[model samples]
Structure formats: structure tokens, C-alpha cells
Target: MAKSMSLLWGAGSPPCRRVMIVLEEKKLQGCKHKLLSFEKGEHKSQEVLDINPRGQFRRGVPSFKHGDLVVNESYAACFYLESQFKSQGNKLVPDSPAEQALMYQRMFEGLTLYEKLKAVIGYTWFVPEEERHDSALKRNKEALATELRLWEVLLVTFFPTVATLFRFGLSAERYPQLGGYNALLKDRPSIKASWPPHWLENLKGQDNLKDI
Candidate 1:
């Protein structure tokens, strides 16, 4: 039997885009999908909320498949898809215990940690502008930068190849860490497959964050 996926999603949300990228990388073509649009404020409809596990009383969980495995979360979905195929193609996360540990560390830093920082700065002040406090925004900004520095450190520690580092502009003199990490991740065909969907490119110049 063929497996299918429902990509519960909205416009320009990085997490949703990340999941789409992983699906493409896995080449899990047999799955079906439900493309939920944000323009219509569909994520908030009770139907979407009920399926999401994140207490996401607001949005539904997007899922993907390859045969029998139904997966969720951009990170877990990628890991499961790759693990199921056991393909010799580019590996997204290394199989080695030591390297896998490092990969998880960096991946989580980018995924989970970043979400917290964004939440502190944006979600915490999610109220209308009339209620937003400059003091809180300032505090959030400081916290966000501090959390980002953690990623800078992880990049250099993980990626060692110079050729791979060029994409993120991490010259040897500046951000050596991130440059190196980019090099490490750059060669993986699987990771490349996970690049944000073409639709995400629509976010190129929109400075203000929109509800997705």
C-alpha cells in the first residue's frame, strides 16, 4: 500500500516550509497532502487545531509518509524519512553516534532554541501595537541576539569544510564556526532537497511578520 501525507501549512512560515523541504528531500512521492492556506485563516479553524499535538489548539499537525511511517515535525520527519530509506545518498544527520550527537545539538539549536527566542521577542508581545511595550521589545532583542550567538558557535564546531562555508559568507576571519558548519551541511543532497519551498521565496522583502 502507498503512504500519504497531509502538509498542514500556511504562507511563509519557516517551520511549515522546513517540513515541505524535508518531504521533497525524502522523495516520498506516494503520499497525499492537504495544503492549508493561511490567507483564509484556516489554521485557527477547530478542524486544524484538533489534529495538532502541540496543544496547537490553533493549527493542525502536518504529516508525511513513506510506506507505513507517518511522521510530524520538520526535524523528526526528516530523520524518519532518511532512516526508513537507509539510502546511501547524502545523509542529513550522520549515522555515527558522536557525529549524530553533534548534529542533533546543532539542529535543535536552530529549531527549538530559535523558536523560544522568537517567542520571547514576538509572541510574548503578540498583543496589538497599542499594548506593546518598548521596554519588553528591547529586552526581547537582547535575548534573541544572545540565543543566536549559540548557533554561531555550533556552526564553527560542526562544519569544517571551507567550500561548504562559502554559502553563508562565513570567511575564515569572521564567523569561522558558522562557515564551517554550513560547509558540513552543504554537501548533503538530502539537506539540499529540504531547502525552503519556492513559495517561501515570496517572503523576500516582507519585514513585518504575518500570522500564519
Candidate 2:
């Protein structure tokens, strides 16, 4: 079953890592994958564009293909995997409706958190130097801080799958609960196995949020 799956992903991307974690948890290790380079704009290459047209707008990668089914969104692809292969390895989705609803909410909220995070750290990289402003960067950091606080409060309710925040300079000292949660998650077999390959090469990550 895994043989029919193909993934186009960037190792440094959290979204791509999420799908990779799910795949590992589900024992779908045989799925073919193309590791793209974001630095080289490989995510926007013709190979990715063939599967996800949005690649033209920098909205690609982490694309999953299962037989004829193609899912471009990271979270949706994860849901599809959990729903279709519930009997395989680990059970990700809950049996009760209430728990499932909470999971869905957290999943979507995670997307929002990722966007806010990118807004802060990616501002200088994504925006043109001529158009960049200190005020805009300050606003982005404030938004990300607010989002992080929300997640910190709910940290105990779910596993810490969004460790990207820490990599980008979210101080574990400020959010002790989240820091502990992330530490526990780091030891999980799936998470450890799916950790970004590039990150393994560089133990120290970027500190874009040192002041946040």
C-alpha cells in the first residue's frame, strides 16, 4: 500500500515534516519521496507544479500522492491518512465525536500559528528589503507572541507537533509547559524518525524570535 504513495517535500519545512511523521507512525515507510530544496526554489519546480498548481505562488511542497488521489494541503493529507489507514499502525484520530472535534480545532489552529510564526521570522526573507519596515516586523512579532500564548495554555491538551516554533527562537524558558511538552514529544519514535534531515546536520537553529 505504501508503494503507491509519493511525496514532494522539503526537509526543513514543518508542514512537510508533519506528513512525514504521520507516514512513519502509520508504518508507511516505503512511500517514495523527492526531497526538494527551498533555498534553490525546488518546491516551485515543474515537478511540484505538475501536482500542485499553487506552486507558482510559493504554496507547494508537502504534496502527497496516493495512487490517483492527490492531496496538496498538509493537514488534509494527514487526515486522509488517518481516516483511510486507521487499522494500520497508531490511531491518531479519536473515536468519540467530542475528542475528534477538539483534534480538528487544534489542527486548524496549528495552521494559524504556523502562519503567524512565518510572518515574524520570514518577514525579512520573503519581503523585499525596499518594502520592509520595522513597524511591520514589530506587529508580526506581537501577533506571533499572542498566538504562542494561546498554544501554551492548551499545551497539555495535545501533543506538541509544532516544534518549529522552538527552532525559530521561541524560548522554552518563557513557556515552560510547552517546553516540557516538546521535550517529551522529541523522544517519540515517529517524531524522532521524521525529524528534519537538515536540522540533524545543524544542531543550533536560527534565532529569529530572540526578542519575542
Candidate 3:
């Protein structure tokens, strides 16, 4: 019999979203998805702890389970999926050594950018207004702005090669190239299908994360 995989995840998490994108890209036929709730503290529940005793939930949402094998962390899970399920749909990790290296580099940068973005989101939105640190929020926003500008610069010089790095939300005025790239990624079937439902509801009127 073919192996079955279980995926545990929280909604609206970028790491979870990343893994979902990979899962959709690979079109895993026997995977089961379980959505966790932050409001209900589902991540800290005994069920999750039973599957992953020492897993770092902060690092990623979607944890993968295939029989006795378990993988946590979005990057590790995505890479594992790409490596193990190659005979199916989209190839995420690339073939050539040079191309693979480039893809890895972009993925690494994108992950770093997401970390900063998460910090910004945490301070500005997730955290209670009374509990949020103004200084930390300011610093995180500044750092994110710097990284975004760097990506914009890269987009100008290496549009074709680095375009995939700008696959998420972006500002049109500050990052015209990345904005176009974001549109392309948003249009992707996998990305569209796996997009955070809550984000779509909340961000409907917003153009960018500049003010947030």
C-alpha cells in the first residue's frame, strides 16, 4: 500500500503557507491536512505534542508525518516533499547544480524576509496594542523596509533570475518590479488555492503593508 502523510498546520502562518504551496505544487495524493487554531491553543495541545514532542512550532506551522517518519520546519518539509514526490507534479528544487544553488539562495533570502515580515506583523497587528513595544516595532519595520528595497534593487538587475523571491505581498510604488512579480505569484493556481483565508478577508482594501 502507498504511504499516507499527515500535515498539522495553523492558518495565516507564512511557514504553513509555504509548505501548503509546495504540497499543492507536488499534488500529493495521499496527504491528510489538519488545521490548528491559535485562538484555541491547538498548537500547544497534547495531540500535537504526541506527534512532535520537541518540535519548534514558532519556526513553522505544517509538520509532516509519514508512517514513522516525521519532519518539522517548513523548509525541511518542503524540501522533503520535493525530493520524495518528484514523479508527480511541479519540481520545486530545480535540476542543475547552478540553478539549484540560485534557487536555494532565493529561498533562503525569502525565508529571512518572511521572518522580518512576521516580526513586523506581530508587533503591529498580532500583539495587543498595550503589550507591543514601539521601539521593536519601529526597528522591525525599518529592517523589513531595508530588505524590501534590497530585493527591489535585485529585481531591477536580475528580473528573470530573482523574480520568484518577490512572490508575496509587495508595494507597487516602492517595488514596481516586485509588485508585478507578486501579481504573477498570486495568479498561480497553487498559490491562489492555498492563500490564507483570513488574510484575504482583512487585506481586501489594502494595497500594501506600508502602513501596517
Candidate 4:
């Protein structure tokens, strides 16, 4: 019998989306997906706790359960999956030491920017306008823009293979290069298959990076 792999995830989560992209890329079979509801505190339930006791934000969503081995932390899970399943799908980590080092650098940089992106989203979308600190929001937006400019330079250097781990896009007028980057990879099978479901329904005018 094939081994079972259970993915506990929440929709619209970047970390969760990252794991889903890996699973899709590897084309894993006999895997089960369970969506958790934060509103209902499903993640805190005993069943989930058994699989992942940490359950903290960083180690929370995007957890992978295979037999008795449970892996949390999106990067840890992703690296383990990619290394273990190398024979199955496209090799996510490169073989050359220098290229691999560059890949890790990109991932770490993306994670740093992800925190800033989260701040932008929290301040813009989730927080009420009256409760927000406009000054802080402005600072975060500018910081995120700066990081994106760096990404544009890297994309030019790497030409399409850089930052394949994260899906970030922006409006053309605001970020022409990143916008073009989004367009370039919009149709990739992994991205297309793992595209956020809600975004698909309201695709016409939705800005993928409105918060930034």
C-alpha cells in the first residue's frame, strides 16, 4: 500500500501556498488535504495538535504529516520534500554549490520581505483605517518597494528561475518589473495549479499585491 501524506493548511496563507506548490510540483500520490478554520480554532484542536504540537504561527500552517514524521516550518518542510523527492519532479534546489547558495540567499531575502509584506497587508487590509498608523504603513510600503526593486535586479540576472518559491505580483504602474515578472510566470503549471481559489473567481480587477 502507498504511504499516506496529510497536509493541514489554511487558504490564502503564503506559507500554506508554498507547501501546496511543492506538493503539486512533486505530483505526490495518495495525499490528503485538510483545510483548517481559524475562526473555529480548528488548528488548536487535539487532532491537529497530535500531529504538530508547536502550532505556533511560523510552524503552524503548511504542516506535512507522513506516518509518524511530521514536518512544520514552511522552508524546512519544503527543503525536506524537495530533497526526498528529487527523483520525481523538477529539482528545486540546484546541484552546484554556488547556485544552491544563491537559491538559499533568495529564499532568505524573500522571507525577510515577506514579513514586511505581512505588515503592509495587516495595516492595509485587516486593520481598520481608523486604527492604523499611517506613518508606519508608509514606511513599510516604501521598504517593500525597495525590496521588490532588488528582486527585479535579481530576476534580470537569473532570468526566470529566481524566487520560484514565492508568488508575489504587483500592479504594472506601481511595479513594472515585478509586474512583468508575474506575467512571465503566471502560466507555469505549478503556479496555475496552485493559484489561490478566491483570486480566480474575482480575477478581472484584483491586484495580487494590493497591500504592497
Summed backbone clashes in each candidate are: 9, 0, 0, 0
Q: Report the candidate with higher lDDT, 2 versus 3.
A: 2
Candidate 3 residues lying further than 4 Å off, grouped into runs, are: 1-3, 54-60, 124-133, 156-170, 200-208
Per-residue lDDT of candidate 1, residues 49-149 (tens digit): 55544524223445444444545565676666577665633456677999888777766666554454455534443557787776866666556546546
TM-score of 3: 0.79
> Per-residue lDDT for 1-212 in model 2, tens only?
99999999887677788888899989999999888888899989888898998995347888899999999888889889998999999999888999989988887887788788779877977999999999999999999888778878888423434577778777889978878888878889988877788788998888988678
Local accuracy of candidate 4 as per-residue lDDT tens digits, 59-143? 4577788776788787788888888888887778888999989888878777876677777655656677788887877887788
Q: What's the best-to-worst order under lDDT? A: 2, 4, 3, 1
Q: Write the per-residue lDDT of candidate 3 for residues 1-212, one digit (tens) a residue.
A: 12377888886676777777778878864578888887677887777777766644443356778777888777788888888888779876678999888887877887677667667655545677788787877887789888878877766222212222332334466667777766666768777766666666766433236452
List the candidates' TM-scores in order. Answer: 0.63, 0.93, 0.79, 0.79
Sliding window of 10 residues with minimal summed lDDT for model 2? 156-165
C-alpha RMSD values across all candidates: 6.5, 1.8, 4.5, 4.2
Quote the lDDT for 60 in model 1.
47
> Where does candidate 2 stray beyond 4 Å?
156-161
Better of 1 and 4 by TM-score: 4
TM-score result, candidate 2 = 0.93
lDDT for each candidate structure: 0.50, 0.83, 0.67, 0.68
Better of 2 and 4 by lDDT: 2
